[model samples]
Target: MVTTCDIIRMMNRISQYRQANRLLVIMPTWVGDAVMATPTLRALRNLYRTAHITALTRRSNRPLLDACPWIDDILSAWPPQIKIQRDGAQGGVFGVVRRLAAGQFDTAVLLPNGIRSALTTMLAGIPRRVGYDRNGRGFLLTDRLAPRRQLGAFVPVPTLDYYLAIVRYLGAEHIDRTMRLFTRPEDDQRAEDLLVDAGWSRQIPLVVINPGASFGDAKLWPIERFAAVSDRCVDELGAFVAIGGASKERPLLQKVIDRASRPIFDLPGHGVDMKVFKSVVRKASVVICNDTGARHMATALGTPAASVFGPTDPAWTETGVAVDRQVRVDVDCGPCQLRKCPLDHRCMTRINPQMVFDHVGELVGWNDELKHKGQDQDNSVARSVGYS
Candidate 1:
């Protein structure tokens, strides 16, 4: 096995000149940010057209990377949480760094704004290192771009746009904001089968509800609010609901499912791998989620999505690039981007459940009164035709 340090040296030699053909990308380890990095990956593909682009990311997020077409290779950084865990797991980072150095990448784009990502790319000795100038890692990066804007009072942008800025540093003239993931046709078939197995109607529009956000309390919408919106979808449109997330979020997912009066197919802890998960979202008519990884996944899969934002500004990766809309309450104190709320999480709590329900109704392509009237008209037509 090649050592990461040796790989770095080799990559540096190959990349000393402009090879453009062999480019390596370092992904943000966080699941949400990993998805946000998709636009950057797409921008690279757009610029190079024929370059082999490999992405270095955490092992747990391999499924998402595997399903993405923009990535040529999926390099795993085991214990993807290692950086966040460095205070507890310190001894093995050098070994991990060494393995990374062995890949012989020409150009390295670091998506995570942390010192660790830049240091790893530097340690790997990739010739060209690119990232934002933050976290005191400016010396490690060869290309540092200024952040587009500061966070505002209530305007939330998505994180994907921030990651795409690196592509500009690589000389990309046109940057597309649409995030993308690719799935095999068989994967879509499998998801359809799963839906049928769960007694869901494939013909009816599908809605995926993800009630968890991993960025702590910064981006979470109230669970009760999620349930309220879910119930309206079921009662009004008779649409099938698929609740998805990892095993860790099951408790919160269950709470939303329990509050919903309509029956929902709970896929929490359902071992649906990333490919299948992408397929699931692909078949969904719309996705309702917090500003979590799944929201980005839904956009990549081309599912119209409504993502709620709270503490984190959506400026880096704005929602609705491919989704229909991003629903955030106009709270005066929101976009604080804090892990924990200093003021009782009022930003998220004040959003009325009715507001979410109203948003859902809009996406389903009808207002509440319009839906009722349409149903009444359909009933009248059936009665006039003597079919009822």
Candidate 2:
């Protein structure tokens, strides 16, 4: 004696429950892009409080979300040959897909727009696949969103906003745009030990200088320019200088340290992990770096940064905070988004050491009282974003 309308209503409720229960998110490959997607992850967690959210990202970027409360689990998206083996099989592409299917994810949100990301979800038999309609993968998605276009071409939106749009399409509400990061007590202790070992005191103002950019030489500011700024920061601002970069970038960073008139704490060759790097940035008075992951990390840690922009547009990577400043020179053939520059690199050359120092002074108050203020102050963006 049940009515057809009642049956239909029951079916709809069941469908909604299924869609909200288990979600797999494909994360962006680059470190900076992955950091920018954090707010979207936070929004998804808030919207589906009961859901189990898994992030699929490169093995190298797994540490980026180490203590992020929004993420429930982590899965490596490394090519199957490189992934860890499980379930009595040599992990190849098909083997990985088989394991993914066993997870029974009801929905997938593709933060990476590549066709392979969509294909993985489809092959796993996920009931819902949502992503931007790029790389000719629209046919694979259940909810294909068109990219924002201008002048008949897709315009580059802020990476933070681009990821947020996907979650909004999935009915997530009350989005907060603040980026957040966390550090462990061990990381803080390590940072302190490194500073003391290098004959630096935690009581003095510290300025971290990052001279290497993973993108290419076009994005790098001149090493001598970095040395000049470091020397000035030491002399004028009474700041201790620390040179930071990945292990592969040790040579480049050493060149800057060698040129500096003052001694610099060499952080690159010391085998400092990401957590330690974040802790160091969190304690710094200011960070000056090329447009790279360190720049984004400093912004998320609520540390003032003077981020230099050359081959990339600042608008696309805006920190969305008042304390962060972008130093760039708008030269004619610039913001080309190229890994290598064919012409003279005027864009970076025009941005001198003085220009960067001025921006740092403006973003981070140079007064004695402000310079000595602890990072734990109430005005810190990290506190505002629910982290310390």
Candidate 3:
């Protein structure tokens, strides 16, 4: 239904922002980037309390913010990179442009650094466009921030801060870099039902492991290593271990389960949507995952997490607030930031199970003394795990 003709017509009818009563946020296309953009959204909400704040993101990433209180509503716009090359959705590039145009937003905030984002907002007839001036799109922005770079490439700034700089440019003073997320009651109830059905007792401490990374296989740690860690949690820590998958990571999740000695509770492969998936993450005492969006999900939910890093730089995902437990090995080739590994995948492979399990133990504080002593105190577990 979204045609090039409709898109062009909308652009021709461009109107300047008088009061910016209605605002549109052009969210990052990737899930990890989307999660990192939460603080910026919160800042926008605080600054413009009366304005209607709507987030425009990819269809898949849209569900992750279902319970986010900062935005009034969210809409999906599927572009080619995700729609055509990866996810088979009907909304092509033009369709996305068309949908964004129909929103009639006053001020648009471009989150992703892609030139396509700047171009689309301009085509949507959004006056007062704001974004980082990168990829030769400075001419398209009404207000643009020059990116910080070293020799030639941009610096590996923490993602939350990288997004928050735009908010500062918009005249925000006090910056809160706290990454946050929420879950619905219905989804929590559904998660409770499913967790119980899967033999997870409410009394047992929950440890969730995400073996899959949507980024690429380069970010994945060995499945056998994950299985070993799961078994350690069950045997040593006396915890209920669960493994989850995103959309296309079911087989990877299954492999972790198949190789494990103990029974692992399944989260995503059980037909739960991203909303329900988040509730499960919230209920977890500690989460273990690959360097993916799930790592940010856990942090946002205030659940202590342990992450395995490989191909990507840890500097990119670092939340300025929390000290997360991360397991990685220094290899010559990485953090190469490659989607696929060309040679031996030594960065991830060398990080053994014990390395991850030790950190998980620290995050969980699984011993009986620490558990019983800290039950009544606020953030006692977090304090113990050094989350703050």
> All candidates' lDDT scores?
0.71, 0.81, 0.80
Best by lDDT: 2
Model 3: worst 10 consecutive residues (lDDT sum):
376-385
TM-score of each: 0.80, 0.88, 0.87
Tens digits of per-residue lDDT for model 2 on 130-161?
A: 88999999999987889989998778789999
lDDT per residue for candidate 1 within 1-388, as digits (tens), equals: 8999999987765543344767878888778788777778888888877888888777778777765667688778643344444443423566656666677776787787788778767876787887888778999888777664556332334676667666765667767665567678788788889888887764576788988877786677878788877777888878888898877888988888888888878874566776787888876767888878887776666555677777866665664442345677767786777988888787788777776666666655532232345432121232232111
Question: Quick one: ranking by TM-score, best first?
Answer: 2, 3, 1
Whole-structure CA lDDT of model 1: 0.71
* Candidate 1: Cα lDDT at 168: 68
Where is model 1 poorest over a 10-residue stretch in terms of lDDT? 379-388
Q: Against the true structure, candidate 2 has what lDDT?
A: 0.81
Candidate 2 backbone overlaps, count: 0
- What TM-score does structure 1 among the candidates reach? 0.80
